[model samples]
Target: MSGLLHPFIQLGYGLEFKCEALIACALAQASTHRKQFSRALDTETFDEIRAGDLDGGNGLSLLDIMELMRIDPITDKITYDDDPYTEENRALSQTLAIKYAKLWSVGNSESSVREKSIEVMSVIALVYGSLTRPGYRPVLEFGVMHNLTSSYFLPILLDALPLHKKVRLLHAYAFTFIYIFATKGCPPLHIPPELTLADTHRAESAESSSSGNPWMEVIDKAIANNDMHVAKVVRALWRLSLLTAFPTQPNASKGYELPPYINCLYLARITVDSINMSTRRDSVTDKLQLTAQDGRRNWAHGMVAYDEFWAKYGQAL
Candidate 1:
């Protein structure tokens, strides 16, 4: 097999350089400036480049073309999502990935941040579709599934706005694709369990009955895992915690204090999207044991606040 494969690999590479020279010559005419190669290429017909479906084009092997485009699997940082590299298209997967990682780290302001993140994600989706070969349809489909499902959290998670506003944004994004996926019999897709944020109030329910700090314990475990999504969720919760019953400075006034359990549910629902069925069962058991003395009224009020907040900010996004 190696004997046959060695010759095939050599032949494939020969085809690639032959394609590259032709592309370089064709695109060179589009620009007098040699430095404009990437920009000029970016504007060219990319369909055949993407699908390797062109007739009598360059006869370049898909892997060879991708290699010349700097998508060589062994040496290049960017992995192939698709096939042939064309004279008209330039690779931007690595560029966009670097940009996203930076934005995610610095954190954006509420309204502007959401818009920017969506734009970035759109670029990512397009590039993924355009650069891969037709044979990679499943891999591409899986990527789309993962991205769209995971993206459900952005509007809610990043919005510095109130709970209701976030939920409305979430619902809008969710409603766009939720029905289609649900009809296929998928549960409203859950974020990876490690990625979902637990509200401090929810975290505290068991501990409030015991003598310990339930929410803090949860944080400790989350930290030990060192998960980025979990950490981001924790940051959002900390900001929300100021509004909840969690302990803070004594000087903190009304709006900054803890709200109700209902509010926790509303926020959690928005921020995390799909509820874990098991967690819901635990919630029911906890709710059953509650008395008028057990803080349900406060929880109820929080839900109201969430509703009111959502009403005001829902359309902002």
Candidate 2:
């Protein structure tokens, strides 16, 4: 649950490949994360709250929960320091994250587990792909992007765990997602209708050939690029695109609707476009020159100012 999800991701790969060594490494990594997270996980304080919350049946979906948090006065109270590792900042943020995250329930049944996992995957994609400042060039925020990439492993990890462990893992994952979102200043989400409708529009067009599929170009660039993050994000979004295609109906019983903005294929295209804008091919080597600093420089970090984000675009809205 810590280390920006690297430990869990490693464990996912280990399980997928049936490799003992990688699993061992993941366990070792988990042992080194901040003690506060471990303590929070061990505490039973939320058990009663969770039970009472679940008694009313299904709670709000992750997307709805995020919206509540976004507008809540508490969101304004979450402040970040230049050094994110400051103990005071982390303590305050994690406390709030757990408080709000408990609002969502990971059900005990197998079908519930599967449904909850998909719900999470969709919401994270919405956050990662849609939370951009209008009129400015798209910049995938560094921290928020991890929530999407880390989610790619949820299905893999959940499949191997027992029902109880699966529920616990989802809780931890939710906590992490909320904490990161708060730290990123709870940026306002805006789903561009054009981006979400890209797939539908393409299918109806005359030029709907294999060569015309935008994903083909996105994939080519992703594979050609040397950055591992680009490849991971592309693969994750592609997997999500496939998963989202068939589940057209919102789960009324579970109280979750597939938000209109979640078109994973187009989200993948947006990510690739953003990366292309931030990088240039070296003339001599004919390869992209992407450095850690270059990646950080082009992305928005910390809180997003509401006034600035809406300054130029508010009139149309």
Candidate 3:
């Protein structure tokens, strides 16, 4: 019990507690004071886990509590749900926890900027599942984090991985997480019941045919129009695509460069839900252009803010 309970105690205490303290507390509660530890794993545990107030591990980790309670030699009811803890639920919860913990740990580890960035990216990739709507669904629909954090993780994570790895991971993570998010229309931080593999694949195929292929379509249109401005926008989009292909700076010379394509993307975003012929033309007008200086400033500001944020609360990542 002490061994199994240690992670929970650590997580409940926000992992800020020392290992020795965690051991002491867990043993003291579960063994010396069995009543207290039992209560700790009861309804009270749910709030701490939900709030992320726990320490070394997530409060609801399958390995830490759910699995132990379900798979133990004992045969008593454990979960808050009225239903008994079934093998299926236990397995699903454990799979989720293990993957969640690994990525969460990476985003929380003590490492260099480059290493930390890579880990963060990997974590995002793991969460997103693919580059399409299917991959992004789980994270976005989970609403566990705001769309800003949830949607951005993939692009950022791809920045950290090796160029070769990023492309593949991006495809997988983006497709899975995006599919979860877009279809469900949920916020980033929430979680849903089990999502089937078939539904996810179907969503991926549909998105690939239309929305995911928007850039190439736009480029083709730009080429036919002989529009330099539109051509530049396409070029920028092409560059932004590279960012996902190779997320992080490989060396000193390969520092961050803002992709100019986002201007058109953002413009598209502001008007996607509404369709006015005049407004559409106006949005595409020359004034809609985004300048390099604007891009540089925005990139620099974001980078500085991210670095500062990590430097201050890096342990929590």
Candidate 4:
């Protein structure tokens, strides 16, 4: 989860393409970043929780755990001014994140793994789409965007692991999600109203005559764009759309329940459109490179002020 998710992402790519060298490089990268959170992540308490020994042995769903983090007073008090990466702050945040995250049980069955993976993917996508401030230029926050992209690797990583390791990975991933939400000023999450299948069809049909299929348009733009983030996000969202095409009732037993409004296709469209609009107004390449040089300044690592975010790239109403 550290290194702004680079190691995790690299490992995903390695698993995805079956590249041993990339996998090795990712492990090497991960080794370097583990010490900072080792105290928080490597404790017996967390291990017990991960093993389903706590919370009645049937932990909360991932979304439920997220809600807990959102409403927790302590998390709400954490702000960008607090400098969350400092050793003291990082330890505190990680402990809190792990506390909430442990309440989400990683079920033992393969079916449970699939369900949890989809749930994680859906929740992150919902967050990415929902974080945009109303009346703004619709630019997705760079920091929040990584959560969505990094989650793309979950299914890939889980598929190759055994049941025990799968549980461990899921626990760590859930913890990372909570930690990010807390550190990013605990931004309010306002998920849009549910988009029924009919609603999505009508919306797509309305745009198809002139645009020739909204999904294709998004895919085309993503492929043509030089931005890796653009391509990765589009691809991930497209996969999510397929995985979540058939809406299901919220079943607490499965530990995965998506809200009615979280249509992956709709979210994907919004993401690409926002990225396009944002890039047109600024040098995304330059900004990405400059931020990459300093991880803290990188849009994915820092806290962006809401007002500054609204006016980023000199964008006007």
Candidate 5:
């Protein structure tokens, strides 16, 4: 992983490296990347990577690799979704975990910021490249899960993106990777309750009934606990995934403003200068309730912005 990202980072695709690598890896597979990688990880071969068919190549999910290495157990609480991870791939995952762990540490460290950042991107490439094979893991790991987008990693990533004109491309590319990984991959072929940004709107729904707007609360207790099966998650993901590569900003003049979040869904993963708005303190429970008189407000419209965004960019990559 130390030198894996070197090719992409040098090409100024740091932020976009994962996306680019995802495409490259997918093309290498069967001319498609993991159905666009969860639209998760795509690789050198397609038939060998799908679940339940480990015949042609090595079939190891990231969890299997990590469990084989005995790493990330504390931070990543996940189960083996496939067959028992045998001793065959044990050595491979261990070697990967070593490089994976190094990248994780360097990514968070403040020392040698620039070099460390390059190494981080390289590791992403290296790891993803490795997974392009049959025996490799298929999704992001504990430190790499896109769902952690809302957590401390965002700030760390923000810090890594130096505020320099010459290096702005790095920020963009880095963000591109962050955007998809966060929104798309939760668990392999599954979107956990937390991964769906739609639920973030739902989390704030109950509170919207009162004076406080739906956008006020970012993560609602209810939404976090809400669980849907993989089938529904996959369908929603497909509709949303194929609709747009990048998430869009709202046209609304005002709405509740939750804690600030970076929008790297579209913007070529260039800069944090995308857009930051102060949403008005209002919410509509449904499309019909978009603008009610006294207490007919709803948060469905809050969710509409995203739905419409995918529709708007429906034909894009």
Candidate 6:
């Protein structure tokens, strides 16, 4: 959660929603109170265990890892305290969040500077502007942090959240957490649900209305342009994003069910495999991996803001 938020803040989009992610991380970290994860997971033992788990080369059971790491598990329901929005705080749909983000990444007051900057700037402004007004954080749709902080422990509630919110959570997990865990190596923050397309399709379809697969759209565009390199990146992003949204069970191929956190190494194994495929995959991924890892700590540092910019503007390149 902090990983995703602090980066956006440094990127000059200090919207409250991004702040919410950090706050959520702190609150959840402190939820146990007896032994704060903030203090415990920092020790060398935990880091060694994290690395050792990867070296073992086996199934990464999040439940077993959580027991070892002593990270509290969320197994219930939780929501934001404030619903003072213009409308409601009903989990900002992922589609809506992306849509709003896309909308924000555009012209503002009719006299903005630079052409390309407008798109990204508009998104920052939309979220930031909506946030300054007191009752719009929930309306704008950036619950990646909320879910990260809360959802890991309470995956049962994933369906309750709006489609956009679910998408935001998946985006954060794959783009931020999983990426960091795989390359830079870090403790797994939260475990995404290990459900499958079959596991979640019914509910997600009902909630999202199947507005044509977003992943397919990306793939289609790449094929149309004859850009295999772009296709590789897009495919990697799609794989991670999809995992966040509909993670397969531990033995998904063999058939299993899980809503548990696994080993960081095992998680990383799956994630890196997901991201680094296709002949076109190459060193360009280093930059993306760095962004995911660095964006967490470092405050006004560790920034990784250009993913959306690149994804949206891939055609220009």
In order, candidate lDDTs are: 0.29, 0.67, 0.29, 0.64, 0.26, 0.26
lDDT, candidate 5, residue 221? 17
lDDT leader? 2
Please give, for residues 1-317, the per-residue lDDT of candidate 4 as tens digits. Answer: 45638888999999999999999999899877646566557677668557672332656766677677767777645554424466555666776776777677766777666777777777777777766455544446565677788888888888889987887787777777777776665566655564223235422322346464567777787776545687788777766665665554235556445544456666666655555322232365444233221111223334433344345432444
Kindly list the per-residue Cα lDDT of model 3 for residues 1-317, writing each as its tens digit: 22332333232343333346754564556454334223223454323322322233322221123223334332122222222124443334333333332322111222222342333333332222221122221111112122223333334444446754443333233223322222222112211222111122111122355555554455565454322333433343343334433435322113222111122233222122111112112355646442332111111111111233224322220
Where is the poorest 10-residue window by lDDT in model 2?
Answer: 308-317
For candidate 5, give the lDDT of residue 193. 22
Candidate 4: worst-modelled 10 consecutive residues by lDDT? 290-299
- In candidate 1, clashing pairs total 16
Superposed model 5: Cα runs more than 4 Å off: 1-81, 97-218, 221-224, 227-317
Which residue runs does candidate 4 get wrong by more than 4 Å? Answer: 1-4, 51-56, 82-89, 194-213, 246-250, 254-257, 276-317
lDDT (Cα, tens digit) per residue for candidate 6, span 1-317: 34333332222211323555664555554453443123213345333323322243223222232233222221011112222111121122221222222111111211211221211212222221121122211111123222222222222222334644433332232222222211111122222233111222221232565465443444555454332323433332333333333333222212212232222222222222222212233486543231222111111111112233223322221
Clashes of each: 16, 0, 54, 1, 27, 12
The CA root-mean-square deviation of candidate 5, after full C-alpha superposition on the true structure, stands at 21.4
Q: What stretches of model 6 exceed 4 Å from their correct place?
A: 3-37, 48-80, 83-317
State candidate 3's TM-score. Answer: 0.21
lDDT of 6: 0.26
* Model 6 residue 135 distance off true place after TM-score fit, in angstroms: 25
- The alpha-carbon deviation from the true structure for residue 60 of candidate 5, after best TM-score superposition, in angstroms, is 24
Worst lDDT run of 10 residues, candidate 3, spans 296-305
